[model samples]
Target: MNIRGKLIIIGGAVDKGSFTETDLDKNVSNNLNFFEAGILRRVLVEAKHQEKSRIEVITTASKIPREIGPEYIKALNYLGATNVDVLHIERREQATDPEVLERLKAADVVMFTGGDQLRLTSILGGSLFHDILLDKYQNEDFIYAGTSAGAAAASNNMIYQGSSHEALLKGEVKITSGLGLIDGVIIDTHFVQRGRIGRLFQSVVGNPRTLGIGLGEDTGLLITNNSRMEAIGSGLVILVDGRQIKDTNLTEIELGQPISVNNFAVHVLSKFDTYDLKTHKMHIQSSQYI
Candidate 1:
């Protein structure tokens, strides 16, 4: 059965959304306005493509406010999503409600807000809501959108615990399980700013079965129906293909001598660029590069 209809993995939406500090306190990032604007544009455009007048924003990360807050609801509304249901499915929240499951079954677009990736998986894993999403994504007209931590969960393997600096050092790479929406790829958000190339590279070296993609802040990778991907947003998308690697001299690497590997190819994609996962090649719509 077909599982994922469409998926949009966003790096970091700092401007338009909220962030939780390492200590779990709520801290608003600086670029929420811009983040909201860019995300709204993407949502509206996607909805227009499906010819749907409205989209559904399922907010499962945050607490249950008296009602859907204006900031989030307004963002969806401006993007043409007439109906926004903020489903609070935090770890402390109850398991998937039957009513919410039915609503999710009716949704054409499912958006996961940014927060903590760990919390998101913990709450939704093996729950009825997660099962319903899997079923609908396989059989219905649904598009999944995830920003930041939500984006991290969109992949098969998530980097929940690690910084760029630590990853660059020898024997210091860490990763955790993810939602596995898109196979053959390990996704990392807030890429360039966090200097996550090392961690991504380590993931590839550890598992040559998947490609490593690092998306910069405010950027995204749109995975289409045919498994072809396109880069969007303001920054660049980094693709690391390690399938051809012959040897990874990781065991003997020092702290800062530049980790070495064989046949590890890297590519940078911007807007209008398309990447084919099956063939592992990237190209502009009309231009070619090899």
Candidate 2:
């Protein structure tokens, strides 16, 4: 099915004016705040209007929703947004609240913040709110944005648990169903900084038909039609294609065993680079994002 909405999947730590959290690797010396490299401004630009369009920041996955919600508001306000609001769906019952669904329906852009992906799926998945959101995104002029856990959970399949150190081992990476915003693709955040390439590889190797995307810190992809992906932000976006695999013992391997695979294709993209999910090819945009 073709989708009309936009998907902005970010790698997190994109200087929301109050962003100071370290990535999965605990790197404290990130030099991203000094310039205009953050993707929040692009989020505002992606919306229909800066002043009038309502942008809803959903913080269901965040443990500190009260804190993260306001940070997004501050960041969007800085980008000239005047009609921004925060929604914290703390429980399953809250997902079915009439007022909450109405608020979401009125929003032009709904962004999911970084946190626990499981919380988002368990709480909002299969609910009336999810139905409305999916319907609106596929039919209306809406935008769906997410960072970190939000980005990971936006896909139909999610990697809920996996350590970078043991990702290459069979069965080390655990997968689960997500919000079902997009399919035939898997997303992994903090790819460069956290060394999560292995898990993404395992994800694609397990299912060669699936494409894996690894987003670096402060980087993302602006996806449209659920097929065309334009790279955004300062860091890198890696694509893992396992469609050409010739030989592999992944199915025969036991738990914790190192699975081997051949002919895994990889692509590294920067800002402005566009990828076609249908063709499995990337188009380069000469203009530098930095």
Candidate 3:
């Protein structure tokens, strides 16, 4: 099935104008606020729902919904998205609320914030809200944007918990069913900054058919048709392709033992780099940089 909607999967730590003078460094001081230049702003502009597009910000993944929800609202509003609403559906019952569903259906864009991916699936899974999300994604032109845990929850195979140190060891990474907005893929957030390449590599090794995307902080992937993805933001994204794996010791290794794999292709992409999910090929157009 061809995906009709667009997805903006972002890494965590998006700047929100809350950076203090002490936090300003060479890497951050030169960048615009999250609402101004990063993935968030890109999503708002790309949505193109209308002038002043209506956006539904789902803060289900966040433990501190109250804090995160308002931050997003303020940022969106700053970016001229005046019709932004926060859907703090923390419980299963709220996920089925008529008002909540109405808000979701009417919105031009829906965004998920960073937090616990498990909470998002647990609360909204099998609910009418989730069904609507899936339906809209396949049939409508709505925009779905997520960051951190939100990005991780966009795939069928979700990486809930895993430490970078133990990523190479057998059975170190935990995989669970996600919302399945984007299939045949696994997503890991805060990639480069947190050194999560190992975990992403493990995920791809376990599910060779599924592509692994490791999103770095302040970075994002603009996914369309569920097949093509374009890198956005200043940071990098790591793509791990295990389809050509020639050999591996994963099956023979016991729990806690380090495993090895051969012919695992890894690609590091920056802004403007594009990837084909089905072909597993990257296209770096010179015009994109010009």
TM-score against truth, every candidate: 0.82, 0.92, 0.92
RMSD of each: 5.6, 4.4, 3.2
lDDT (Cα, tens digit) per residue for candidate 2, span 1-290: 87888899998776665554444223322333523555877777777774568999999999999988987886676567899999889999999999999999899999899999988899999999999999988988898999999999999999999999999999999999998989999999999999999999899998999999999988999999999999998989999999999989998979999989989999999999999999887887884553
User: lDDT tens digits, residues 132-205, model 1?
Assistant: 77676666656788877788888767877766776755557767777767778888888998888988888888
| Cα distance off (Å), candidate 1, residue 283 | 1.1
Residue 133 local lDDT, model 1: 74
Model 1 residue runs over 4 Å out of place are 1-4, 14-39, 48-54, 62-69, 251-259, 286-290
- Candidate lDDT values, in order: 0.71, 0.88, 0.87
Q: For model 2, what is the error of residue 102's alpha carbon versus the real structure, in angstroms, after optimal superposition?
A: 0.5
The candidates, ranked best first by TM-score, are 3, 2, 1
* lDDT (C-alpha) at residue 159 in model 1: 76
Residue 37, candidate 1: C-alpha displacement in angstroms: 9.2
Tens-place lDDT per residue, model 3, 187-222, is 999999889988988899887888889999989999
